[model samples]
Structure formats: C-alpha cells, structure tokens
Target chain A: MTGRVIVITSGKGGVGKTTTSANIGTALAKAGYKVVLIDTDLGLRNLDLLLGLENRIVYTIVDVIEERCKLKQALVKDKKNPNLSLLAAAQTRDKTAVNAEQLKSICDTLKEENDFVLVDCPAGIEQGFQNAVAGASEAIVVTTPEMSAIRDADRIIGLLEAKEEITSYKLLLNRVRPSLIKSNEMMSVDDVVEILSCPLVGIIPEDTGIITSTNKGEPIVNDEAALAGKAYRNVAQRILGEEVPFLDLDEPKGFMAKIKNAFAKLKAKV
Target chain B: MEKGFVENGFIIDLSDAKNTTQLVFELSSVMEHPEVKRKNVCLKLGALDLKQSQLLSIKALIESMDANLAFIDTDSEQTEASAVSLGIIVSEISDNLEPSIVCSAAEEVKDEEVVIKTECEVVEEDKTVEVHADLNSNANPIETAEGIEDIYDEQSTQELSEIIPAEHFEANFEALAESEGLIKAEEASKYILLDTGDVLPEGAEENDTNTETLPTLYINQTLRSGQTVSYEGNILIIGDAHPGSEIVAGGDITVWGILGGIAHAGSLGNVTSKVRALKLNAIQLRIAGLYARRNDTLNVPYVQKTNEFTPEEAQIEDGKIVIYKKLRRD
Candidate 1:
C-alpha cells in the first residue's frame, strides 16, 4: 500500500509543530504502521532531539538529498519502536541546500516503503517552509488559541487554500484552555475552527510536563497522563481514518473534587 | 515530441535519438514496459533546445504515461522545466487519492453512498459530543482514557502507553498552574500609583524586607479565562487580558488590549504600584495592600456620570475598596 505524507507546520515558532510531528509519528507507529518523521527545520533541527533520536541519526535529510547517504540510511529507528523512525535534519545546513522538488522526490522514495511519512516543517513561510511543504501530500497546521497564533494560522490556511491545498489541510490547536473558553476568557476550539474554516484534527491542552519533556528530548505522548499526549494520539488515529471526537478543555472542574484528588495524590505519595 | 503528422494525427520522431545509449534505453522502456503505458511515445531529432522541446516532450510523456505518474528528475533545465509544468502540485494529487480511499475505507453497512451519509452523521455526532461535554461539567479528563480504551477494548493497555499521561494526571500544588490553568505573570510598573499620597503607611517602604524583586513578563497573547499570570515583578501583556484570565504582579501591570481579568499590582507590598490596560473591567483589582471588586449594587449609571475616573476613586476609602460610578460629584 502507498504511504501518506503529512507535513506538520506552523508559521510561528514555539506553536508545537515538532511536538505534533513526533507524537503523531510515534502514535501511528504504535498503531502498527511503519512511520518515519522527518525534521525539515535544517539549521534549527529539533525533531531528532524531541524524539530523543539525535544520537541515532546516522545520516541527516541533507545527507540523503546530497547523495552522501540513502534515505533509509538516514532514517533513525526510534529505540522504542522499530517501526517508528526519524530522518533528522542536518545541524549545519540551511534550507537553501534543498528545494521542494528534492523534498517531493525524497517523500516519494519513502512512500514506497513506509505507511506514513510526517515532515516537521520549519517555522516561517520562508524557503525552508516551502521545501518542507513541497513533498507532503497533506498538511497539519499547528497553532495556539491566542489570537496572534490563530491569525497566523488563518494566514496559513488562506495560503494553502489559495494554493488549493485546503482540502488536505487539518488544524491542530495547541495550548488551549477550555476553562478559559467557558468563562469566555479564551477562544473556543469551535471559534478557532470557524475562523480558520478547516477540519479540527486535534486539541492539545497546555501541560507543564510538556516543557519538562521537551527539556528531556521526549515527546509528551510518551506520558499517557498528559491530555496533550492523548490528543496527539487521537490525531494520529484520525489521520489513519478513524473518527475521534475532540475533548473539551473548557469544562469546569469540580473545584472541591480537584482539591480532594490533589490531597489523595499527596497522601498516596506519602 | 507530439507534432501533427497526418493533418489530424500526431507524430513524434526520434531521428537523433542515436546520440545517447541511456536515451535509447529510456525510449524503449517507455514504449515496451506494460506498467509504463503511454500514447504516441516518440522522440525527436534537431538542434532541439533541450530546455524547451524536451520540457514539452516530458510533459506530453507524463500526460500520456499515467494520470498519477510521479516524476523524478535531476537539476537539468529540461527536467526542471518538465517538473515545473506538472506544477508538482502536492495537494492536488493527494486529494484525488482521498475520495477513492474514503470510499473503500468507509465501513458501509448498506450502500457505497452510505459512507458519505455517515460523514454527515459523524459531524452531528461530534456536535452531540460537544453538547455532552457541556453537560458533564466535571468530567475528569482521565475518564476519557477509560472511554477511549473501552472503544477499542480488543487492544491492550500495553499497546498505547504514553510518556506523560495528561489525561491521568496526579496534580501537584506547585504545579497547580499547569493543571488548574497556566498563570503567566505580567510585568510590574517602574513607578507606583498612590491614591492617598498624604502620608506613607506605617510600613510603606518600596524597598522593604517583604518586597520581592519583580521580573518583567511580556505576555504575547490574550490571557484567556482559566489562565492566571502571576509574577514577582512588573507585567506587560502585549495582548488582551481576557475576562477570565488574571495577572498578579509584584509591581505594576499594563495591558495592551482590554483587561477584564483580575489584576493585582504590587502584591509583594509595594503600596505605590498601579494597574493599567487599554480598557479595564477587571473582576477584582489589587494594588499594593489595597484590593477592590466591582459593586453589583447601587444603579450607578454604567456610563460615566461625570468626567473624573481614576484608580484613586476606584480604591477603598472606608474599610472596603470603593467603586465610584462617577468621581463623587463634589
């Protein structure tokens, strides 16, 4: 079966595109599909570090396109999943070294073997971003609910639609606060999707553990307790043709119950 | 490559094809290969500006070869031009593939169109799901995993373990911000705003033992509800502070957008601090040791009764923080 290539991108930095790519790749591979996540950030390559595969990236995407190594040679298998691999971006090379055509060729080569190929696009609408999107069959635009990020996402959506890539585009809202939404403090997922006019693929709540995990070069999906982790996993499932409902981040928590649970956990640890 | 031969018919001639063996192999391969099917497979000979004619020929070749003939090329001008002609429009090819896949992938209990019909149903189901979330006010996020697992019961837990189970979080008090909400502290102001400047409080020292050095927090996004920002220094919110979000700074707080959230400036006991926003409708306002809340009573015209409107009038005169509709007219 031919594999699908999905590019995870966000025009703004720190909006969680790399995180989505890593988690979705892992989630898909865990679901039994052979998956390869490519970091196309080049100079700011972080997918390898995010997946903790930096040490295993024998060759980088740059090396493969430059003919220094084969595509398979550059694929670093996730120590956790033999089926999950990472094609790390070169640390020193700039996005100029490659073009969209080169990326398309690279993705084509991977499609012949893997079930899913996810490209972690660089932040910005520059050449690097172009090269990253050039090869992918579909796109996952990641953004936060903040108006600034949402506005950027809207710009991206407009570009993709203008380019006629809208049909294949999906949205992943990160760092969302449902409680804020209920209280009319933050934008609701519905409001975001309505504004972007795109299909909602995932909703990732802001989790501090994500920061800790990033510091450790581990994706939050590795932590089952993190809501963002499940959200990403659900995103992967959706990509695999499964229908999953979005979770409500704005639901009011039973304050007293939460306090009780907080005490329970404290008591348990003791 | 495709030029008209018999008035209405087209022909492609490969007279000078004898130049390269690789070209010969490629020509024969396109003609004879079963999977590499094509119509009017022909070559041409001439001063052929390989850039112009070869590019056209490759386009004709791909069009004739297969609807989805994925192209591969090196940096040669002709090849580059050929690739460009196809426009290598990434999304188009992918979208053309989805319908067929969606059709086959769709589990039809009835007819093939059942899939399309189900698509609508699925959306409706999504709406209901959201409605359900609304009804289940205190739905523990962890329970979602149990529901998901139950949906796919055949799969074992070993199959889908995550590194951080946010759905099944064991909340920590210090980490309460992460769970309850993230409070990014705003920046404090350099100079404090004093309502009663007559006499300093008994322990009113800007640099007192109780005072903590405040850090500058430059918040870039609208602080939405459930998001609280607390800092030891001044807070500068570049975006709107949503009604539900609160910013507590040890110094001063300034918002670029409408500030509807709670703002506490000089929480570290800096009595002279102030809070400012483009539009302020904070649920609770605190500065230094003073705190105030909007009064629901006394039909004080929502609109300004008179000209004066300052933080001083908004402060507590007697024991309670004062909420003056219009600066007490004389």
Candidate 2:
C-alpha cells in the first residue's frame, strides 16, 4: 500500500524538527502502522541516533540514490519496533549529493511498502531543504515562541506554498514554557497562531524528559509517562484523522484540590 | 444574397438576407476567401436582422477565421447585445444616412466615420465614471483626490511650499517640478484673460517655487524581527514593531500599536521631525542626528508610581533626543 509522505521542517536550526519527526514516526508505528523515517539533513544526520539505530545502519539514503545499493539494503530496522525503520543520511557527504528528483524517486519506492514516510528536513532554506520537501505531499513546520524562529517559519511556509506537490501543511509549536506565558514573559500559543496564520497540530511544552530521552538515543514518545510523549501521541492521532483534545498545559485540579487552593490563597493574604 | 463587398476589408450587409441559415452560409463563404486568410482584418457586419443566436453563430464563424469583427449600423438592440457578449465593438450610424439605403449598400462611407467618432466619445465617458468610483472607496482622507485638486488650484499663485530634502527628494522633484512650472505658465495666462482673483504680491521667495512634496508610506501589518523598512519620506505603521526590527524614515514616523524596536526618524537631519507610538517600549530612538537609549532606571520608578501605561513621543530638543509622555491635542 502507498503511504503518506510528510516532511518535518523548520527554517531555523535547533527548533526540534528532528525530535518531532522521530517521535511522530515512532508513535505511528506503535499504533501498528508500518512507518519509515528518512534523515535528509545530509552531513549532520541524527535521526539514526535519535531512534537508537545508529550502529545498525550499513547503508544510507545517499547509497540508495547513487545506486550503490538497493533501496531495501539501506533501510535499517528499529530495535524497538519491527514495523519501524530508518534511512539514514551520509555523514561524510554534503546536501548536494542527492538531488530533488533522486529523493522523489526514493520516496516513491518507500511509499509502496510503508504506511507513512516521515522526512526529517534540515534547517535553513538551502539545497537540503529543497531536496527534503520535494518528495513529500504534506508538511509540518516546527517553530518556537521566539520572534526569530517564527519569522523563519513564515518564510518556510511561503516556500512550501510555492511547491506544487505539497497539498496540506500545519504548524507544531515546541519548547513552550507555561509559566513564562502566564507571566507575560513569553509569547502565547494564540499569539504564534495569529502571527503564523496556520492551523496548529500540536503544542509540546518544555520538558526535561526530552533531554533525557535524547541522551539515551530514544524518542520521548516511547516513555509513556512523560507529558511530551503524550503530546506526540496526540499529534500522531491527529495525523491519522482522529479528533483528540489537546494536552492541558495547566495542572488539572479536582474539587478538593480547588478548595485547597482557595484556602492557601486566603492564608497567604493573612 | 450578401449585398456587401470587401473594400478595405470584408463588409457583410444582412438586411437583404432572408433567414438565419442563409446569413450563416453566406458569412461562412466570406470567411473562407483566400484574401481574408493570415491577415488581421476588421470584418464589419451592417444592419443585421437575425436573432441573438444567429448573431452568435456568425461571431463564432468570424473568430474561427481569426478576424476582428465590428458590428455597425445595427438598429436592433438584440443584435447589439449579442455583439457585446462576444466582445465585439458596436457602432450605430448617425441619422444623416438614408433610412432604407443605410442597410442596403456599403458605398456610403461617410456615415461609418461619424459612428466611429461617437463610439470613442462613449468609451471616454465610461472610463471617467469608473475612475471617480474607485477614488471614493479608499479610506485615507489625506490621499483622497476630493479637495486636493481644489487646494492646488487655490494656491496656484503662491510660491510652492518648502519641503524638507531627503534622498528621494531629487528624483521626486525632477518629475513634479517641471510639470508644475508648465501648469503655472498656463494658469497665469488663463487667469489674466479671465481677470479673476488677485495675483501674488511681489517679494515672495523665488527659491520656494522648486520645493518638493513629501509622500508618506502606510504599513498595515506587524513587522517581526530581522525585518527592516527604510523610506525616503514619512512612515506610519498600524501594527506592532517587535524587537530586532528597525524602521528608518527621512521625516516623521508614527506607530499606532506597540513599538518595541529601533526607530530613527528625520534621518536626513530635519530636527523638527518627531516620532510617536501608542506604547513606546523601544530599545533605541533617534531623531535627526541625535540618539537616545531607553533608560531602565527612569522607566521603573515612573511605571510604579503611575500604574497606567501611557503613550510616548520622542523628538529632537536642544540637539538631543528626548522622550516624554504624549499629550492629547484635542
């Protein structure tokens, strides 16, 4: 069966594009769908490490595109999930090694065997970005609350619209701090949505577990206890055409908890 | 039988034709002529008596031959309406032509000349009415063309006002300066012959006649960081200017929303120019050659005592940029 190819891109670097790709791909595979993640960052490849499959990669996307090996020979299966696999990038080669047409052909063959192909696009509007976006039919732009990242995300959205192949696109805001937003020190979700003028698919709050998961070479979505893991699952469900409620940023309070909060406020006043 | 011939181009008179079928057959034969092929010709249809569908079919036939068609000397509104729908130009012969012979022959070339002249006049009137409607819909009162023309007329005798020079002032002045001089010469003669209104008294500054007019650019959206807008004239922004974004203007600058960026007004050294914003939390402000940074110590105590956010204005005073609370004028 043909799969849906979705590219995850952010025009600015260090905005969690690779993190979102790894988590979404893992979460989709956990739901019993065959999924493949391709790291298109070329020289700075990291999707293999994120999936804990770095040592298993014998060949890469560059090898498949160059015809050095068959497409199936380069796809390294994930250690955790049998349905999940990864096509790593060539760390020795640069972005120009694989052209857009070559990537398109490679994705076509991958689509035939998998239920979803998540492309982890490199940051910056360069050849790497063009090659990653050329193969995808849908896009997810990852951004933060900062003005610099949001501006670059806007520029990326414009470039995506110019591509005739991409039919649908959505935004995913990452690294958001709820306390900073409540204190008016940082921009809120509504502020970003208004400026970007795109529908938001997910909001991942700033969590320390993401760092821990990254160090362990595993996506946060596998932890099952982390808030960020739950958020990634919700995003995966949304992509599957399921209506899921967003994760509440504020702590959930019950009836007795509300009474305790009121008494605590009154005691502080005295 | 088609009663018309090809003089300058093909002319078909449909008055003598019996029915729509006969008209279509004859027009098809005219279009197939070897002389009409590969030439840009105006095929004139004179005084047709066919229905709208019949006219449409003839129009389609002419278009297939790649010839431009002009419907002339038609008395029926249905034929004219059909021609218009096909994007064909229509003209009516004047009353000077003989009524019966008007549709019978093509020798009376003088009537076609009169019809062409009247068509041009009708198109000109239609264009002016459309322009007037468009000018009324835009929101800016200053840029609207309503009283500005009257103001230009009333001040014709007075010397042109002095405009503060900026980088674009040279190009703008060269384009407008010569045209205004020519208008003044024409107006002076017309007013002298009419003997209306007093001319300007002597001793007015002759250099003022060449002053340039400054134009203001309006921006309606927020400017994010890494964006910079520089203009040779004034600028008015209706949205917020975020930090890291910068605006440089040759004259005054105004922001209707929050201003958190760097703004430099009167960059060309017009010291009187001012900068105003609804919420001025700018990192840096400059007017003319003087510059000032936001004083955190000065703002903290003021904000605590007032407990209300107030708008601010910045201007050059005593060769330095000073910021103060904006006072309501009205």
- The candidate that wins on TM-score is 2
State the lDDT of candidate 1 residue by residue for A25-109, as single tens digits.
9889888999988888876677765766543343578888878666776777786789998888876567888888999898888
Residue-level lDDT tens digits of model 1 in B1-330: 212111111123333444444454455554443423433222333333344454545555556555222323232445445446656311110101223323333333222232234343332332211111221244222101012213223223322212222122112211332222323222121112223222223454443322223445555666665477777766766556654356877666766556655577766666645565545566457666654543322111112222122222132233333332212111
Q: Tell me the TM-score for chain B of model 1.
A: 0.30
Provide backbone clash counts, one per model: 44, 0
- Which pairs of residues clash in candidate 2, taking residues 3 or more apart in a chain or in different chains? none
What range of 10 consecutive residues in model 1 chain A has the weakest lDDT sum?
Answer: A50-59
Interface RMSD of 2: 23.3
- For candidate 2, the per-residue lDDT at B65 reads 88
Model 1 residue B243 lDDT score: 44
**Per-residue lDDT over B1-330 for candidate 2, one digit per residue giving the tens place of the 0 to 100 score:** 322222233344454556667667766776776545543333334455556676666766777887755444466677778767766666542222232332222233333333323333332332211111122234111111112223334434433222333335245323333322312112121111111111111332112111125466667667765367778677767667865467887676777567766687766665666677767766557666555545422221111112133456676555445555533211
Candidate 2 chain B — worst ten consecutive residues by lDDT sum? Answer: B189-198
CA shift of A235, model 1, Å:
1.2
Give a tens-digit lDDT track for model 2, residues A196-235: 9999999998989988787667899999889899999999
